[model samples]
Target: MRTMSITNARALIIMPAWNEEIAVPDTIREVMKYAPDCDLLVVDDGSTDSTRAVAMQAGARVLSLPFNLGVGGAMRAGFRYADRLGYRAAIQVDSDGQHDPRDIAKVLDGLDAADICIGARFAERGSYKVTGPRKWAMQFLAFVISRLAKVRLTDVTSGFRAANQRAIRQYLDHYPAEYLGDTVDSLVVAIRSGCRVTQVPVEMRVRQGGVPSNNPFKSGIYLARSGLALLLALTRKRSVLTKLEG
Candidate 1:
């Protein structure tokens, strides 16, 4: 429910696409409708489909990587692009169309104070279903992150998030190169570097197209690996995420 006047257009919406040709257009159009002023970038992580062409036709600037870099690597490229281009802030939206474009504005409202703002579905309970093992996994990650962050966070694994320039810089220099490690470790690095983190309630939808990259087996593996990453995060040295002078 937090909001700020849209005085400047410094926000960039970044969608990381890997074989998401089926849903990319709708995702871009919905984002364009919701945040018309912001620039859109689709980081095509070497998709075999027409992802690059489709995104371009949908009126997005596409950054096609040489090969598949997975979600984390693609997102890192987006942040780097935004940083280099002098964008003040950026938002990461899923290309699978699972995240609601309408709720993007709500996350942006926290940018005035937060270095990064996460869209947490659990904040609203019945708004979205966590279901079974994924539910327990989320709780454990949230507990670890919140306790380390010294502030209560309801959802830590949620991909829907916003970041200011300082955060972009932080990720540019010290972003994790692993799978789910990027999302989990990047936040810890931001906090360790004294950057503000925040969360807002958001509703999520079932993915419209493209098979999920991770199955239940992969999810379990990710949870186990991410758990170890969290423990190591506690002792990881802080990266320089402070705002720099012009």
Candidate 2:
């Protein structure tokens, strides 16, 4: 793959939002502030709230789905948009403001040498911490995926990721909508399909607004679901790249 520099490449920030009307505006603002050169798109995953309208008002291009399709499906749509519009790279940022937009350029920089660059937490660069079963599950998943990708990854579940054209095409071919499929399974498939992967350490901040997905009590359930997701990823057939030429 040819090396693409964030300095010159046209990048798209793909924010997959679900009923995040409260957080999307601020997140969009921060992204614009930090990555003024890049375009922003919010994939409204069947949001019943004012997410799509709010995002559009906040100056982001919005793609509203008819119904909720989870992060993976939302992102597949985002990637298709990016590919169709001739974007050189795409960056994934959470809609809840957990991801610092300041690191967007850093993640994109990783793509000069890699097909996919993950913004990682718990990589000795941040104060963010997780404990109990969730921590264990994350560590296990990272360990397994690290070996597969041939890189030392500490946060495989992080949603803050950047992808070049190759990675974007790979994702459209096999990105799944099931639980953990967006983060784990799609990554496993991409790595298996010969995409290079790397990570940059990033600090995770508290969510600015909206309902949180995980609670302390649900850590055990997260563990089981993560393990099953990983198992399904490992056993699934490898993805064959479907070429997307502009």
Candidate 3:
């Protein structure tokens, strides 16, 4: 495990919101309730809705993107902000409210001994209200990632995760922007770069809105594309290793 400097131990909570006007405020409020000391940042990914206004009103610093960037882009923006502000740790929480904000503490707790901490909803003790196909896809991706990355991850695509400064620097340097299916790409990069990753149980709720961005068909295509990408990533040698060693 990489040893992080204790002097720079501030934690920043980042929410990458696209069109979560209704749930963003509540998510921010819940996160603040649990992790009161952490600073909150909401990266509005060119939302047509009032996501920026709602997030700002809910007491979060908003990073408004001029155009719609995918999840990876929004998260890269958040990581850049955290790096610029010199924050020691960053926790990513989705604004759709599918992930419980109260579980932020659990992620942080897991981060104490690891470079990155992931919140695994399936490993937790709670009911997950998701479509059958999506659930099965998650399980399938978990198995694939375990084989390719050599890490036993229960929730390979979970957005609810925490990363320390080492991870923040590494991701800001080499985050893949296009065809970012899920959080798996970032996790794979971190793990390959010699970061210690740990998973904790987290309760997940159904989206407050009845609709989800991913339908069964779209999700299936995403899974296929991401699976291929992961295989390619695994076959390639570690670029991060060369940089770190050099």
Candidate 4:
């Protein structure tokens, strides 16, 4: 489906790319076609490859970080940029091409009713398939985040999401800074800060290229890190940060 027409969307698409030279260009082109109304910004997270050049050639405004900041750091930079640019809204799309541009419209729709809109891959009635220990961890995390959110969340880890002006302002001031911090942690931050968050069912395709940083060993570490993060989120004092009233 064509991206929702925002005639005056003033939207920015933040794509964090790191050594994704193989897929970044293609991803940018597709986003350009699907969401032409939105400005595309590719945050090159210090890729050693040609990600910056290729993304620029594909017509995306490129932000080349001096060093690899991981996806979460890169995302923070992108949001800060958006905040300065006076964008009305912004969405995060990975450069690996796993996200379907067609689903962007659906997620953007939630901005009408909520401060943050997530593209949920396993929401009720979603057709995407998730398997293995990864599935178990996600389901457990989803349950934990759902409880904190006071609403059911089927895909708490989804990176594909949109934030309205209110949420974007908060993001500019503060966002969790940690490996894998942007997903569930960001949701907790958003909710605790009083922002209303909602999800839209959106199926994700297999990643276009590049390998995940997960292995058996790393998987165990990830579980520990994420579990610790959630625990901290639970006990920490809720921020006095004002939630956006969109």
RMSD of each: 2.3, 3.0, 4.2, 2.3
What would the per-residue lDDT of candidate 2 be over residues 34-85, giving only the tens digit for each residue? 8887899999999999999999999999998999999999999999999899
Better of 1 and 2 by TM-score: 2
Winning model by TM-score: 2
The CA lDDT at 133 in model 3 is 61
How does candidate 1 score on lDDT?
Answer: 0.83
Answer with 1 or 2, whichever has the higher lDDT.
2
lDDT of 4 at 227: 81
Ranking by lDDT: 2, 1, 4, 3
Which digits, one per residue and each the tens of the lDDT, describe model 4 over residues 131-201?
65567678889998888778788888899999988888777665666755788777787788788888998
- Candidate 1 — worst ten consecutive residues by lDDT sum? 1-10
The candidate, 2 or 3, that scores higher on lDDT is: 2
Clash count list over all predictions? 0, 0, 0, 0
Error of 2 at 98 (Å): 0.5
TM per candidate comes to: 0.92, 0.94, 0.86, 0.91
lDDT of each: 0.83, 0.90, 0.78, 0.82
lDDT score of residue 87 within candidate 2: 85
lDDT of 4 at 38: 83
Stretches > 4 Å off in candidate 4: 1-8, 124-127, 214-216, 235-238, 241-246
lDDT of 3 at 47: 93
Deviation of model 2 at 55, angstroms? 1.0
Q: Write the candidate numbers in order of decreasing TM-score.
A: 2, 1, 4, 3
